[model samples]
Target chain A: MSEWSKNELGQYEYAGGKEDWEKVEQIASLCEKFVIDEEDELVSDEERSCYNCRFRRWTKSAFVCMRR
Target chain B: MKIFVGIDDSRRLDGGGAGEIVSLLTRTIDEKGWGKSAIPSRHRLYPHPDTGYRKHNTARSFSAEVKEQYMEELIDYACVMIKSNGTSDSNSGLAIAVPERMDNTDELIDYAYRTKETMINSDEALAMAKKPGLYIFELSGNGKGIIGALAAVGLRMTGNDGQFRGKLQLGTGEGYIATVKEIIEKSHIEQVKNMDFENLGTEESVRMGEKVKVVLLDHQYTLMVFPTDRQHPRWQTSTTNMLRIF
Candidate 1:
């Protein structure tokens, strides 16, 4: 169900842009490695969403999951 | 006296992000009765390819109203905190600006804007610190943090940059509607503006979203909105994607 592909930097970038709130929350719910980021860094309303994960590095368009 | 504190950290820094450090500093300031601090803002620097940090390229700053006699004590305490919190391999730095003591703040702001645009050298940050009105200190590592630290202070001074540290707890559920006036009183946000930066009238209604993030614009705490054309409310809180620009 995940559509992750390697970006030019060799990091796994999410196909979904930063606003896919529902999709990101679903992914984070099932992700075993999900860890909450600092309070100031949180973007998603869902505390457990991938957007709140500490391992996700923000890119210009989307974010790269560093867990892989 | 109004003073602004800016702090930056290297990617591999071990203790915490810049925001965490600022939060600790703010707490310390109030707990020690030095001064009252405001909410810290997170400023996004240009994500240049050459600058790979341990985390995101964001710095944190906050303004405080401290007593004149305790100013030196506050700065010294902040330096000590950064030293104890940062690891040996981490590069962390801070800049403290006293508006009254500094005359060349316009230059500092220009330097801050440039740091956000391109790669900056520490030497440039050091040179700028030599001028009056600003104090820059390198806490740890190779001292690569001066650029971001100075940029944080400058951007905070602009009164038009950075996102506030946390979201506003306006209401439960995302569909509740509130006018610009109501939201302002509830959230302490001074103004409501659309994505284009146009001011929303006091009577203008907005459908609140899950995350009610506030940004700094025109020297005010601003809540951003966009037209949704929904039946209940004509506007909705701007999504975080839209807020990435801050």
Candidate 2:
């Protein structure tokens, strides 16, 4: 389950809580992915994960997807 | 007089590039001082977040919006014309001419078939043609031929022959025949569907002395199919000389 909050627009929003964040950290640790140098132009592993995340799918061009 | 003209291009099966036809018609209408008219731009006037760029290409989704804009412009022009002429009925009518090609005939026919399949399909094409005093004519033939005829009449050709290559050129005479044939076929189907089979059986069987009303001018042909009964007022020769004077 995800944590929920209400914004000024009276719309419900969800975000990962401490428990969810911990789970994500554990998953990353198990994956053993190496972080690139801070100065490197290469995309971080975390950014790639964000691109493939279910949350991204929900947010991708939200207005267009809403019609479908 | 207030006239609303809707020009469609059926030169290609995918509803060929109508941009040129629309441009020519609107320019002609404006030049003649008949009244200001326009065909909607392919793209939406205002972009919506949801539609993005998709709304720009497909006429099916945007036809209503385009038509509405055209009508609004027409109404405005009509109001002006009325004020100046002191009468609203002074030769006022709508004329819609579509340039179609032989290759696209099957696609257009299929479109008509699908439209007939659905009960909700309003007979827009027929209704547009039947608008009281409005004259509507759909011109179709070999796309290249029609364009070639236009070129032959001294309208400059912009592209290479390969690019503009259309099938056979149906000169004025052949074009008239083809137009008449199309009108007859359309009328035959419509008449059979609306009228009793037995009543039309005699006429259908003989296929003799089957005459359709058509006028062949110097460079253009006009086919007028009465939407209502035989005695009803027919739409006049508005599109008769469209290509002739060009």
Candidate 3:
């Protein structure tokens, strides 16, 4: 949803930190391209969460969705 | 002689991960009789924006048993494997360390812990790589991956860090129950301990959780179980939430 905003680099970064599990899971659950990342890179307990999406890039505070 | 090999790749659109690359390297060495290698373990680094690898802040490493004469051959194979697999935009680095030749391993371990908490540059990593028994190389891109490659070897040296890249299939599936002895015999897990670090008896029952995984602890593949409400099988494999600590 609108929880994501584009930064100056024209990348869509999650508004909150990585701990916003509910939002990320909901977003990933809706996205058609939510491919699971490598098992080693997974952070969230949810298997299909955006935090586990291969296209999401981690920043200092939050993550940017490269697929966006 | 024993050696540790580590590699890091800063991949953006690449379909596969560096773990697969390093895992292939491990298998190749074993297949070639160059060494006997275990599965690769994955290490996490600081994800500070300044570090520049926003795609994935992770590295992979594995330990091997090899003859001292094969060190050069091993390094050459690693360089070729990494260079050939890396994408044009990927920045990859490889690090190999021989603990027997190092003057101080604790210092290297300290650097690994620091890399997990802060940003480290290529020059600093390269400087550390100049140690007597360590070798590091930047295969592509901006070469910042050397930081992670060096840190991964150090982290693996700690003997209590990182998780192996894949899962261990000891049981049929989730909710499968087995005793401590059975779990150990079925997989490479060396020890079965509860979350409190207490050792479980051979007869103690453990219920496999949604995912069965192991972590490197005390230089062994340790399967850590968590307490559950069930009485018959009170212990179960740890979940991903509980395992992210590694």
* Highest TM-score against the true fold, candidate: 3
lDDT of 2: 0.25
Would you list the rank order by DockQ, best first? Answer: 3, 1, 2
DockQ of 1: 0.30
CA deviation > 4 Å runs, candidate 2: A1-68, B13-16, B39-124, B141-246
Model 3 CA lDDT for position B165: 77
Tens digits of per-residue lDDT for model 2 on B26-69? Answer: 55456655455422222101112211112111110001112323
Worst 10 residues of 2 chain A by lDDT: A59-68
What is every candidate's C-alpha DockQ against the true complex, given to 2 decimals? Answer: 0.30, 0.01, 0.63
- Look at candidate 2 and give me any clashing residue pairs: none
TM-score for model 1?
Answer: 0.84
Highest DockQ among the candidates is held by which one?
3
TM-score of each: 0.84, 0.21, 0.94
Please provide TM-scores computed only on chain A for all of the candidate models, following their numbering: 0.92, 0.24, 0.92
Off by over 4 Å in 3: B50-53
State the lDDT of candidate 3 residue by residue for B7-117, as single tens digits.
885654638667778878888888888879987999888886744325587788899999778888989988988888877877888988899999988878999999899
- lDDT tens digits, residues B139-241, model 1? 8877877788899999999999999987787767477889898998887899999988999999999988877788999989999999998765889998876
